[model samples]
Target: MRLAPDRRTLLLGLGAAGLAPRVLAQPRFVVPPLAPLRMEVDRITKITVCVRPFRAAGPRLDVERVAGKRVVHNYGHGGSGWSLSWGSAQIAAGKALEGGVKEVAVIGCGAIGLTTALTLLRAGAKVTIYAKDRAPYTRSARATGTWSPDSRVADAAKVDAAFPALYEQMARTSYAAFQTLLGLPGEPVAWTDRYTLFDGPDPGVTFPQRPTTVPDIRFFGVPLRNLAPHWNDLEPSQHPFPVARARHGTSMQFNVAELAHLLTSDFLLEGGRIETRTFNTPADLGRLKERVVVNCTGYGARALWRDETVIPVRGQITWLAPQPEVRYGLYYRHVNVLPRPDGIVVQYGGDSEMWGYGSEDETPDLAEAEASIRTIAPLFEAPKA
Candidate 1:
C-alpha cells in the first residue's frame, strides 16, 4: 500500500535529491519514535547474487522472425527488470498480438516473462509460458527488492536519439501499473521510508566518480520525481540515529518472494498454462505450436541467442533475518540496508558506479557481504539516555 505518512508533512523530494536540502524555516512536525533494529553478522540468513543484463543501448524491444515464428524480444532491462516489468511487457505484448493472434508463447518465466504472459492473457490471448524455471528459482527473486528504475539502465552517451523518450514512457508506465497492485493480499509491492545517514551535512555529495577506462553508469532523469512523496531532514532530537546528519525519504520497493507467488496464482487462475521446457537456439523455438513468441530470457539470452551486447553487471545481497519492527531502509558508507518481508538486504557498491561492471561471475563473495554488514552496524547502536 502507499506508505502511511502524511502527505502535507512530507517535503518535496525533488529538492532533496536535485538541489540542496532546505534549511528549516518553520516548526517541524512531530515524528513518532521508531524501534531500534537488531543488526549483526550472525543474523545473516542468506546471500544471493544476480547478474544484471545491462545493454548500453537500452533494452531490445523489437520484433524479428526466427524459424518462421514472429519472436518479440523484451529482455535486457539491466537491474530494472522488476521495476519496469509491466511497462516493458505492455510494449512486447502489443507487438506479439499485432496480427490479432489469439494464441502466444512466452519464453522464460522471470519477472519480465511472467508479466508479459499475464498481459497477453488479459488481452484475450490464450498463452503458454515455456521456461527452465519460474520466478522463485530465477535471478529476479534475488533482487534487493527496491525500486531502482535507473540503476545502470543505459549509458547516456551511447543511447540513440529516441531512447530517452522511450525510457521515460516505460519507466512511468511501469510506475503507474505498480500503483494498481498495491493493497493486495500480500504487500507484493509497497512503499517504505529510507534514511541517508551522512557524516557530512550535504547528502547531495555522492561517491567518487569511476575512471574513464571503465564503463559509465547512467543516472537518467527520474520520471517519478514529483510523485515521490517524502523527503525531509529528521531533526536529531526527534530520532536516536547516531549519525551527524540524516535525510529521510521514501520510495516504492518490491517483495519479490511474495510477488512471485501472487503473479503465478493470478496467471493460473486466469486459465493460462505453463510448461517446463528449454531452448538451446532460435531453431528450437520452431517446435512450439504457437506462431508468436515473446523472448524474456533475460541474461540467458546472452548464450541462447548468442547476443554479445547483453553485458552482465554482477550484484549481490546479504540477507539478514527479517525484523517486522523495522519498516524502513537506509544508506551509510555506500552500503544499502533495505528491510522487506523476506529479509533485510545489505549491499555495498564499491567506491564508484563501476562496482560490478562487465562481470559475469555469479559467485557470492562472503568477505564482501560481511564487510557490507559491518559498514552499517554503527547505525543500529542503542541511543544513550
Candidate 2:
C-alpha cells in the first residue's frame, strides 16, 4: 500500500505518484463541512483480513548476544519491522561490518531483508538475499506502511540511554535514503500527513518538542513541550469531529510493492545477487559463501532460529475505496485508519498486544477484520452540522 504524497516530499524532490482524477484535478483541500458527529457502521459485505497469532512456546532473545557465526540478528522487530527496516538494517550492517566481511547473506526477503541487502550494497559488501518468498507476497507487504516508530521497537529506556541516539540516527539515515529513492523516476517513496485525533484528557505528551536540524526529525502536531496555547485550532464550522485535540505529522509512506522492487533493483544494479533457499537450521548460515549474515526472517525466526523472544502480534487491515479527499491519517484509541493508493487500511490491535500471551498462530480472522472497522468508526464519523 502507498501513502499519498504530502508537502515535504515535493520540497525534498520526492514526487508523488499519478494522482486520481479528483486528486490531480484539484490538489487543494477545502475542509469539508462538519456534519453531526454521528458514527455510521460501514456496510462491510465481503471481508479480508491478515491475522497474526502468537505462541508463548518460544525462546526469549538475549538481544545483547543476538549475533552468531558473524551473523547479526536483525529480526524480531514485530510490528515496527517494516517502519524501521532500513534503519535497523543500517544498524545491523554497521555491526556486521565490524567483522570485516566484504560479503554478506541476508536471511529473509521481506522489507527487512530487502533493505538490508541495499544497505550492504551501499557499504560495498556483496549481498545475497536468501528467502522463501518475494515482495507483495512477503509479510512486510501486509503492513499499513506508516512511519511512526511506536509499538514496533523495544522500550527506548530499557534498551539504553545510547540506544535512543542509535535509533534516532538510523531513522534519520533511512529517511534521507528514502528521500533519495523518491527522487528517482518511479517516485517509489513519499510522505503523507497523518492526523491522530484524541477526544479525552491530554495524554500530556508533546512530539518534536526538542528541535533537531536532522532531516527526518521534524515537529509533529505541536512542539513536544509547548503547553501555552496549541499548534492547530478548530473552528466550530470546520471541526471534523468533536475531538479534544488533534496532532498531525508528515509521515513516511511507501508503496510496499514498489519499494520491494526498488530495493531489489538497486541491489542488482549494484551487482548484489539473490538466491532462493530455506534454512531449516542455523547450520545453513555456515554453508553460505558469505561469512557474515544479517537475519531478516521476521516472524519466521520463531521456528527457523528457534527464537523465543520473537512474538507475533496479529494485525488485520480492511482495504476500502481510495478517499483522496481525506488528506490525513487517523489513529484514535486502538483503531487506526491509514489511507493508501489502493485503498484504506484499517486495523485494531486486539489481545495480540498481550505479546507472549496468545496461543493462536498466524491465522487470518475475517471476524476480527470486521471488528477492527467497528472499533475505529468514531474517527471516521462526520462532524455535526
Quote each prediction's TM-score.
0.87, 0.70
Report the lDDT of model 2 for residue 103.
80
Where does candidate 2 stray beyond 4 Å? 1-69, 155-161, 183-187, 198-233, 242-247, 323-326, 350-360, 375-385
Residue 302 in model 2: lDDT: 74
10 residues in a row with least lDDT, candidate 1: 201-210
Q: Write the per-residue lDDT of candidate 1 for residues 1-385, one digit (tens) a residue.
A: 2233343324444346655454433344444566666668899898889889988888999999999999999999988898889989999999999968999999989999999999999999999999998868988878888888888777777888998888877888888988988888769988988888877322232333323336456644445666567678877765567777788888898888988888888999999999999999999999999999999999999999999888888888989999888888888888888888878888887766667778877887877777777677656653422
Total clashes for model 2: 12
lDDT of each: 0.82, 0.58
TM-score of model 1 vs. true structure? 0.87
